[model samples]
Each structure stands twice: as C-alpha cells, then as structure tokens.
Target chain A: MWKSKAKFLFLLPAVVWVLIFTIFPLIYSLRMSFYNVRIGQGDVFVGLNNFARVFTNEQARSAAFITLKIVVIAVAVELVLGLALAILFNRAMPARGLLRTILTMPLFATPIAIGYLFFTIFYEEGGLINGLIPWKVPWLSDPGLAAISISLVDIWQWTPFCFLVFLAALQGLSEELYEAARIEASSGWQVFRHITLPLIQPTIVIVLLLRLAEALKLFDIPFSLTGGGPGTATQVYSLFTYRTGLRFFDLGFASALSYIMLIVVMIIVSLFFRHLRQIYD
Target chain B: MSRKRKRTKGIIILVLAVAAALWAFMPFYWAISTSLRSPLETFTIAGLGIPFIQFRPTLANWIDQLSIGETQRALLNSTIVAVFSAVIALILGIPAAYALARFRFFAIKNKDITVWFLSQRVLPPVVTVIPFFLMMRSASLLDTRTALVLANVTFILPFVVVIMRQTFADLPVELEESALVDGATHFGILRNISLPLAAPAIAATALIILAFTWNEFLFALTLGSRQAVTIPVHMAGAVDTRGVQFWFMAVRALVAMLPPTLLALFAQRYIVRGLTLGALKG
Candidate 1:
C-alpha cells in the first residue's frame, strides 16, 4: 500500500502541472470563447456570438482554408521527396553518414531563422532564387507564389525528418524478403511495390500524421517571412488567431478561432489514429 | 547486361543524392556567407548575387549584433529560460517517468497517462496561449522571464516525460530488483542505478528540450514583450524594426542556430532515437 502511495506521489507533480497548465487553460479558453473579451474590459458572456463571428469572419474562413491547403500540399510533397532520398541513401554508398548528417541540418534549424533565410532567398531582385534564375519573379509579392514559397520553406526544413524516419524504417526491414524476391527474378519495381511499400506503410502513416499536425499549427514561417503579408496572402490559421488575440486584443474571438482550430485538428488526428488502429488490426 | 544496368542505376542514385544534399545545405551556406559579408557587400547586387567565393568577407554584422544590448539580453534570456525550463521539467518528469515505467497503478493505466501527456504536446499552442496570456497578465508575470519559463515548461515537460518513460521502460528491471534486495530504497535505486544508466538519454532529451524551448517563437512572442524576449523573438524584431538588414539577420540566425546545431553534432545518434520517441530505433 505504501509502495502504491509512493508511486502516486511520484506522479503528483506532472499531474498537477497538467491540471494547472494544460487542462485548466483548455477549459478557460473554452469558457473565454463564449465571452466578449477585450483589453481593459470585463469579459461579458455573449453565448455563441464569438463562434458565429469565427464562421462569419472572412479572414478567419480564408485562413482556415489556406492552412489546410498548405498542410496537405507540403506534407504530400515532403513524403515523396523524403522517401526518394531515403531510398537512395538506404543502400551503401561512400560518405553515406556524412551525406545524411548534412541532409538533417535543416531539421534542427530555428524555424524563424529558416523563415529569415528564405525571406532573403525569395527576395524580388536580390534574392538567391532570383539571382540563380534568369527572369525576375515576385516571390513574396504575388499571393500564389508567397504561399508556395512558405510551403517550400516548410518542405525544405521537414523533408529530412521524413527521410530519416523512412531510412530507419527501411533499414529495419528484413533481408530475407529481398533475397526471396531476387531468387524469383522479380523486377525491382515489383519487389519494392509488393514488399518495401507494405513494410514501411506504418512509418509512412506516422510521418504523415506528425507532419500534418505540426504543419496545421504553422505560424513562425509566415509570421517571420511575410508577416502574413503582401496583404493576407500567407496568413495561416495560427497567425490569424495570433493577430486576432494578441495584436487586436479580441480574446473572445481569438478563443473561438482557437477552438475551431482545435476541433479541426482533433478530428483529423482521431481519424489518423483510427486508420493506424485499422492497420495494426 | 545486369551489371551494366546496376552500375548506371547506382551512378544516377549518387547524382541525385548529391543534388539533394546541396538543396538541403545551400541556404545554410548562404546564411553563413551573408553573415560574413560587409553591409555594403550585402546591399550591393554584385556582392549579394554570387556565392561567398566572389566576395570580400567581413564580420561587421556579427560585431554590430553582438554589441547591441538587446541582442545580448535576448540571448541571455533564451539560455536562462531554456536551461531552467528543461531542468525543471526533467526534475519533475523523471520520477514520474520511472513510476509509470516500473509501477502499475490502481485506476489509471500507464498508456492512458502517456497518451494524455503526449496529447498536451499535440494541442496547438494557440489554444493555450489566450488563457495563458490572460493568466500571466492577471498574475503580473507577463513580459517576464518567469512567464516564458512557465509556458515553456508546459510544452517541454511532456516531451521529457515521454522520452524518459520510454528510456526507463527499455532498461532491464533486474538491476533495480537486485538493488531492492540489497535494501536500497526505491529513490536510492533510481538515483544510483537507473539515473546512471539513463544519463546519455537524459542528456539527449535535455538538449532536445533546450532546442525546442530556445527555438520556440509563438509562446515567447505572446507571453514576452521585452524583458523575456528570446533569440527567435529578437530575430523577428530585427526583421520588423530593421527591415531587410540581410547581413544582420543572417548573423542573428546563425547565433540562434548555434546551440541546437552543436548539440545535434554531438548527440546525433540519440537525437534520431529521441525524435521518434523510441518508436524506431536509431
């Protein structure tokens, strides 16, 4: 009994921390969503008005769509590129470890730094991309290009993460399967499609889910790069929420916006988990 | 035919790998090169257009940024906040991790607790930022390093707990059992036996947490105004206030990247394992 009590005591600090920081804030934010909160003013209960504003507000709606678009497009491209890199590097090559180390350098870089680096790289006249290419393109000025540019930065920083995960998964694969395929004179494509793909499917799903979650909360890149700028061209959902809550001091509306984001993420994550369970079963 | 085809394929793969490495590393090289260039060189098309080999390198930007008080203060604040928050989280989290790893509890399943902890990490920071902002404001802790530390603890604690829990679980139980038979208390066993065993993992976990806290922008931006501004926040401020000082921005970015990059170089093996939360072995 004492041992069990000691175990509970051991867990107490983390539990209390969660209760105070995470759980309480979640509840408080939920409550704040229903109030008309402004700076230097009392939070007046407004009963669903803030949530309605979230739906009615054009910026918020557009931001939601843009966030989804970036997440999907970026994650998909990253998976393909990362998988290709992983496959290429999975086999023995000279300086393989050194190459991998360099590849992963981007993964640990400060996102804000990446944003600033890319900000310079995508500059209209003096940018690296423009300097390298013949024709001048407005990278951050044009709306479509700005969005693509931001996604590209994300892809650059994160593809290595996917690559590393996939490499690990590939290395873990059994050698016997490949030997059997070789004995049968199976083509490379057929062997890969039948064996490698199925074997690494779980890691693929895990990487996708991780990337989707992180990408959905995208802010630092857009915040630092364009400041959601050239208009609201690159203003993602989190940045929109930030502007609403902190910049504008409309806590009520911001809380609502946050809740909407929360719901969307929760739904997506749960769906992924269900799929993951299905795969296991 | 097969040997020739295989050679061709290998060559193509090698070429592609070289291309991918250049793609990954070019921007970082640009950042360093830009940081080393004089402001005149940075602004002029001739200097900015080409790679580092084409330019007269200078340390003017690095000198200017380091001399600035705000940049120094921000770097100091970042180090303090990151180090302290990581320490605090590890202090509180390690024992809990051990408890979860070793002991089966009455009502709560270990898996449930772990999932709950990880879920805290997954929830978007914006969801928690509003209330935290208000709470800090009311408590008169806003813009203070304490506020940043507390907020960082919220996110990083779970990661520490999760990683350490997995580390503890992977450790063999017989050592602790033998210690118990020797009349060592649970705490004693954890301190003397489990801690030494898990030291490498702990170091890796701490470095990762430090990196996360140092690189964290959203919470720092929201919770800190001036007094607690971190390196990332300082970089953002330079972007906003200074406006396209490419050389200066590059210097700041490089300074900001130093800790995590160095840590990564030292702890690359553990980082791969820690990142995957031990689900995939390095």
Candidate 2:
C-alpha cells in the first residue's frame, strides 16, 4: 500500500502539469471555438458560428488547401528520395557514416534559420540560384513557384529524417529472406519490390503519417521566408491561424480553425498508432 | 557482376553521396560565408556567385548582430528558458516515466497513460497557443520568459515522459529487483540503480529537448513580445522589419543555428529514435 502511494507521488507532478496546462487549455480552446472572441472584449457564445465561418471563409479554405498540397507533395517527394538514399546507404559504402552525418545537418538546423537562409537563396535579385542560371526565376514572389519553394525547403529538411527511418528499417530486415531471394535468382528491383517493400511498408506508413502531421503544422518556414506572401500563396493553415487569432484578434475564429486542424491531425495520429500496433503485435 | 560494372556502381554511389552532402551543407555554408562577407560584397551582383572567392571577408555583420542589445537578450532568454524548462521537465517527467515503466498500481494502466501523453504531444501547438496567450495575458505574464518556459514545459514534458518511459522500459528489471530485494526503497532503487543506468539516455533526451525548445518559434512568438523573445522569434522579427539587411539576417541565422546543430551532432546516435519517440526500433 505504501509502495503504491509512493508510485502515485512519482507520477503526480507530470500528471498535474499535463492536466492544468495541456488538458485545461485544450478544453478552453474547444469552448473558445464556439464563441465570438475579439481582442479586448469578453467572449460571446455564438453557437457554432465560428466553425460555420471556416467553411465559408475564403482565406481559411485556401489555407487548408495549400497545407494539404504541401503535405502531399513534400511527403511524396521525401518518401521517394529518402527511400532511394536509404537503399543506397544500406549497401556497403566507403565513408557512409560521414556522408549520413553531413546529410542530416539540415534536419537539425533551426527551421526559422533555414527559412531565412532559403529566403536569401530564393531571392529574385542576386540570389544564388539565379546567379547559377541564365534566367531570373521569382522563387518567392511568384505564387506558383513560392508554394513549390516552401515545399522544397520542407523536403530538404525532412528527407533526412525519412532516410534515417527507412535505413534503420532496412537494416532490421531478415538476412535469410534476402539470401533465399538471391538464391532464387531474384534481381535487385524484384527483390526490393517483392521483399523489401513489404517488410518496410509499416515504417513507410508511419513516416508518411508523421510527415503529414508535421507539414500541416509547418509555420516557421512560411512565416519567415515569405511571411505567407507574395499574396497568401504560401500561407499554410498555421500561419492563417496566427494571422486570424493574433494579428486579426479574432480569437474565436482562430480557435475554430485550430480545432479543425486538431481533428485532422488526431485522425492522422490515431491511424499511425493503429498501424504501429499492428506491426508490434 | 563484372568488375567494371561494380566499379561503375561504386562511382555512382560516391557521386550521389557527395551530391547529397553538398545539398545539405551548401545553404549553411552560404549563410556563414555571407555573414563573413563585407556589406558591399553582399549587396553586389558579382560577389554572390560563390562565397569566399568573390569577396573580402569581414566581421562587421557578426559584430553588428552581437552588439545589438535585443539579439543578446534574446540569446540569453533562449538559453535560460530552454535549459530551465528542460531541467524542470526532466525533474517532473523522469519519475513518471520510471513509474509507468516499472509499476502497475493505479486504475490507469501504463499504455493508457502513454497514449494520453502522446496525444498531448501530437496536438498542434496552434491549438494551445490562443488559450495560452489568453491565460498569460490574464495572468500578466505575457512577454515574460516565465510564460514561455511554462508553455514550453507543457509540450516538452510530454515528450520527455514518452522518451524516458521507453528508455526505462528497455532497462533490465533485474538490477532494480535486486536492489529492492536488498531492502532498498523504490526511490532508492531508482536513484542508485535506474537513474545511473539511464544517465546516457537522460542526457540524450535532455539534448534533444533542448534543441526542440531552442528552435521553437510559435510559442515564443505568441507568448513573448520583446523582453522574453527567443532567437527564432528575433530571427522572425529581422525578416519583418524590412530594410532587408541580408547580411545581418545571415549572421543571426548562423548564430541561431549553432546551439541546436552542435547539440544535434553530440546526440546524433539517438536523434532518429528521439524523433520517432522510440517508435522505430533499430
């Protein structure tokens, strides 16, 4: 009995902290979503008005669309590139460790700093890419290119993460399967498609889901690089929320937008957890 | 395969490896080089092509950025909040992690608690940002480092608990059981056996948490106005206050990247595991 009491004491602080800060605020924001909360004014209950506005609000809709677009393109690209890199590194290679360490540098660099660095590199005038090429492409100023540029930044930073995950998964594959496949005269691509891909399918799913969760919440890159501009072209959902709640002082609407985002992410994460359990079991 | 085919594959892999390295390192290299370049060179067309060869290097931008009171204060604030919050998180989380890993006493099972913890970690920061902002404002704690620290703890604590729980779970129970057999209390066993055994993981967790807190932007941006601004928050401000001093921004970017980059290098082995919250076992 005493030991059980002591164990509870050990767990108490973290539980209390999470309840007060995480749970309480989550409930507070969920309630805030149903109200009309302008800055310097008390919130007024509005009965799903803010949630209703999300569907009709053009900026919110576009922001959601742009965020989904980034998640799909960026994650797809990272999946391909990361898988390729992992396959390459899985082989016996000279200086493999050194190359991996170097490749992962961007993964650890501050995102806001990365945003600023890329902002300069993607600058219209005297940018590095423009200097390398004959033509001047508007990397940030042009709307179509701006979205691609932000996704490229996301790809550059997160590809290493996917790479490492896949590499670890690759290394964990059963050697017996590969030996049997080789003895059966299976070609490299055939072996990968039939054997390797199936083995790492769960990992691939987890990485994709994780990347989707992250890319949806991406704020610093777009926030710093383009400030969601040339004209809200790069404004993802998080930035839109920031502008709506803090910049526009429409806390109620921002709360609704965030709740919507939360729902989407919760769906993704629960899927990831389900997949994780299937793999573990 | 033929020797020639094998050689060709090796060369291709080498080339690809080098290309990947350059792709990852080039921007940081450019940023550092640009920071060292004279202002005249930074603005000029000819000086932008390749770094170091085209311009005379200078320390002016670095000196300028460091001399600014706001940047210095921001750096100090970032360090204080990151270290203190991570420490606090470790204190609050380590025991909880050990308990979840070793004990099964309460109505709440370990798996249920873990899921709850992860759900908290997975919730988008934007969801909490508004409520936190309102709460901080009401408490007159807005723009204070304490507020940032508190908000950071809310996120980082969950992560610490998750990672450390995995770490403690992986540790052999024999040592703790033996200690308990010798009449050691639960706290005694944890302090003398588990913690020392788990020290490496604890350090790795701390470093990763520090990196996360150091690079965190939204909470810092929303909660901190001026006095408690972090490096990322300051970098965002540099982007917005727009005479567009590219070199100054470069200098700040380089400075901002240093701590996390160095810490990441130190904790490289555990980074992937840390990132996935031990989901992908090696």
Candidate 3:
C-alpha cells in the first residue's frame, strides 16, 4: 500500500500539468465552440451553430483538402528521394559522418527562415531562378504554382530526415543475412526488390506515419511564404484557424474550425496507427 | 570479378553525394551570403553569393539588426521562455517518465497513461491555442513571457515524457533494483543510478527541447504580442516592419536560425534517437 502511494508522487506533476494545460484547455475550447464568443462581449450559447458553419465554410473545407494534398505529395516524394540517397551513401566512405550531418542540417532549420529565404529565391524580378531562366515565373502569385512552391520547399527541408532514418535502418540490417542473400541474388535490383525492400518496409511505414503527423500540422512555411496568400491558395488549416481567430477575432467559429480539424486529424492518425500497430506489434 | 563495376559505382556515388551536399547546403550558404550583402546587391544579384567573387560583402545589416531594441527584447523573451519551459517540463516529466518505465500502476495501465501523455504531442496547437489564448487574455497573462512559457511547456512536456521514458527503460535495471534492496528510495535510485547513466540522453533531450521551443511559432504568435515576441515571430514580421529589406530579412533569418542549428551541431550524434523517440538509433 505504501509502495503504491510512493509511486504516485512520480506521476503527480505530469497529471497536474495535463489537467491544467492540456485537459482544461480542451474542455474550455469545446465549451467555447458551442457559444457565440467575441472579445469585449459576453458569450452567448449557440448549440452546434459554429460546427455547422465549419461544414458550410468553403475556405475551411478547402484548407483541409489543400493541407492533406501537400502532405501526401511532399512525404511521398521525400520517401523515394531519401531512400535513393540513403542507398547511395550506404557503402564505405571517408568523412561520411560529417557528410551525413551536413545533409541533415535542414531538418533542424527554422521553417519561417527557410520560407523567407525561398521567397527571395523564388522572387520573379531578380530571384535566383529568374536569373538563370529565360522567363519570370509567378511562384507565389499563381494559385496552383504557389502550393507547389510550398511543397517544393518542404521537400527540400525534409528529404534529409527520410534519408537519415532510412540510412540508419539500412545500416542496422543484419550483415550475415544480407551477405547470404547477396550470394544467391543475381542483380542489385533483385536484392533490393526481394530482400532489402521487405526488411526496410517497417522503417518505411514508421517514417511515413511520423512524417504524416508533422506534415498535418503544416503552419510556419505557408504563414511565412504566402501569408496564406495570392488569396488563400497556400493557407494550411492551422493558418486558416489562425486568421479566423487571431486576425478576424471570430473566436467561436474559429474554435469550431479548430475542433473540426482536430477530429479530422485524429481520425487520420488513428487509421494510420491501426496500420502501424500491425507492423510494429 | 565485379571489382571494376564496384569501383565505377563508388565514383558515381561520390559525385552524386557531393552534388547533393551542395544542393542541401545552398540555403544555409545563401542565408550567410545574403546577410552579408547590401540591399542593392541582394536584389540585383540573387544568383551570385561568393562574397568578393560575386559581390563585396558587408556587415552593416547584421550590425543594424543587432542594434535594434525590439530585436534584443525578442531574443531575450525567446531565451527566457525556451529555457524556463524546458526546465519546468523536465522537473515535472522526468520522474513521471521513470515511473512509467519502471513500475506499473494498479489503477491505470502504464500503457494507457503513456498514450495519454504522448497524445498531447500530436494534438494540433490551434485546438489548444484557442482556449489558451482566451484564458490567458481573461487571466491577464496574454502577451507576457510567462504565458508563452506555459504554452511551450504544454508541447515540450510530452516530448520529455516520451523520450526520457525510452531512455530510462533502456537503462540497465539491475543497478536500480540492487539500490532499492540497499534501502534506496525510488527517487534516490533515479537521481544517483539512472540519471548519471542517462546523462548523455538527458542533455540530448534538453537540447532538443530547447531547440524545438526556440523554433515554436504558433503559440508564440498567438499568446505573445508586443512584450513576448520570439525571434521566429519577430523574424516573420521583419519584412512588414522594414518593408521588404531583403538584406535585413536575411539578417533576421540568420539570428533565428543560429540557435537551433548550433544546438543540433552540439547534439547531432544523439539527435536521430531523440527525434524518432528512440525508434532509430542513428
């Protein structure tokens, strides 16, 4: 009995913190979603009206779609390129550790800084690409082009993440098993297709799940690059919620928007987790 | 028999690796080069970055940004929030991690507790940010560093619990068990036995948390206004305040970029394990 009580001490702070910060805020946000909340005015209870608007609001719906689109395109491209690079560098090399570290630098870089730097690089009048090209492109202005630009920058920053993880997973491959497989394999493609792919499939799934989680929250780059601009073309869901609440001060509707996004993200994540557990467990 | 083929493959890989490194390195290089250039030089020659080779570099932008009062205040706020939040989270989270890693609770299953803790990690900042924003405003704590610190703790705490739990779980338990038999309390075992063994991981975890909290933008943007602006938030607003001074914006970018980059360099060896939550030990 005393031992159990002693153990509870260890959990006290975390429990209290969750109760105060995470749990309470969740409860507050849920309550706020059901009310007509505007600052400098009293809250008026409006049952499910805000949630109904979330479905009705076209920008809100589109922001959700755009976010999912960018995440899929970016993560898929990153996985392929990163795996290629990882395979390329898996052999014996001098200064490989230094080289690996240098390649992974962007994983830790500030997204806002990366965003602005790319903004200049993509600038039409005197941008880096424009200096090399025969034509000036509307990188941030065109709606379709703007989303692609954001995705490209994301790819540049995150490919190294996939590369590093896949490299680690590849390095962890059982040397004896690989050597035995090599003896029987006829071609490199055959080895990768049969032996290597199956072994790294678990890593690939884990990487995809990890990347998807971070990518879903997409906020900083679009906030910096387009400011959700050229008219909401690149605005991710988080930024949409941001503009709605902070910029426009639509507190009630924004709360509903955020909650709607939260549910959507949770569903996506739970589905991924079921698949993830099938591999990991 | 395949020696010649192997040699050719090595050379091709070497060339591709160098090219990829250059491509990966271009932005950091550009950040430095662009910062050193004058505004006219920046806009006029975007493709050229080789200081004396491309254009004569200048320190005027860096010096100007460093001299600003808002820049100094924002940097200070960022440091205070990141350091305080990370420290507070560690104090609260480390013991909890130990409990989860070692002992199972009879009431709530350890797995369920861990899931509840780590679930905060994937929770969207906006969902919580709305309530945090309103509550902070009502509590008269909005735009203050304290509010920012609390918001940062909400995110950083989950990372602490998850990562440190892995570290503690991986530590050899025999020593801890022996210490307990020697009349050592769980707290004593944690402090004297587990902590020293996990020092490297603790430092790595702290540095990672600091880097993440430093780079956090959304909470800082929403909860912090005039008094509590972080480097990233301020850097985001640099173009508007200075009206697209590309050189100055470059300077601000470097300031915001340097801390996390330096932390990554210092903790690079442990970062993969830390980042993947000990899923991959790179």
For this target, which candidate reaches the highest DockQ against the unseen true structure? 2
Per-residue alpha-carbon lDDT of candidate 3 for residues A1-281, written as tens digits (9 for 90 to 100): 12445678998888898899999999998998999987777899999999999888999889988888888899999999999999988988766777877888888788888888888778888777677788889998998888888889999999998998899889989899878888886588988998899999978887887788778889999988888888888888999998898889888999999898788778766655555333221
Q: Which portions of model 3 show Cα errors greater than 4 Å?
A: A1-4, A271-281
Model 1, B1-282: lDDT tens digits are 999998998888888888899999988888888888777777565433445457767777888999999999998999999999999999989998888888887676666677677677778999999899888989999999999999999998888887888788889999899888888888888899999999998998888888888899999998887788999989888777869788888889899887877677666776656665444565
Candidate 2 off by > 4 Å: A1-3, A276-281, B45-52
Q: Could you give candidate 1's per-residue lDDT for residues A94-144 as a string of tens digits?
A: 778888899988888899988988898898867788877888899899988
Instruction: Give the alpha-carbon lDDT of every model.
Output: 0.85, 0.87, 0.84
The regions of model 1 sitting more than 4 angstroms off are A1-3, A271-281, B1-4, B43-52
- Candidate 2, A84: how far from true, in Å? 0.5
Per-residue CA lDDT of model 2 for A1-281, tens digit only, reads: 12456788899999999998988888999998989986676778999899999999999999999888877889999999999999988988889989989988888799999998898888878777786778989999888889899999999999999999999999999899899999999899999999999999988988888888878899999988888888888899999998899988898899999999999999999987765443221
- Say which prediction, candidate 1 or candidate 3, comes out ahead on DockQ: 3
Prediction 1 global C-alpha lDDT: 0.85
Candidate 2 is graded, for docking, as medium
Report how closely model 2 matches the true complex, as a DockQ value: 0.62
Q: What's the TM-score of chain A alone for every prediction?
A: 0.94, 0.95, 0.92
Give the root-mean-square deviation of each candidate in angstroms: 2.2, 1.8, 2.1
Give the least accurate 10-residue stretch of model 2 chain A, judged by summed lDDT.
Answer: A272-281
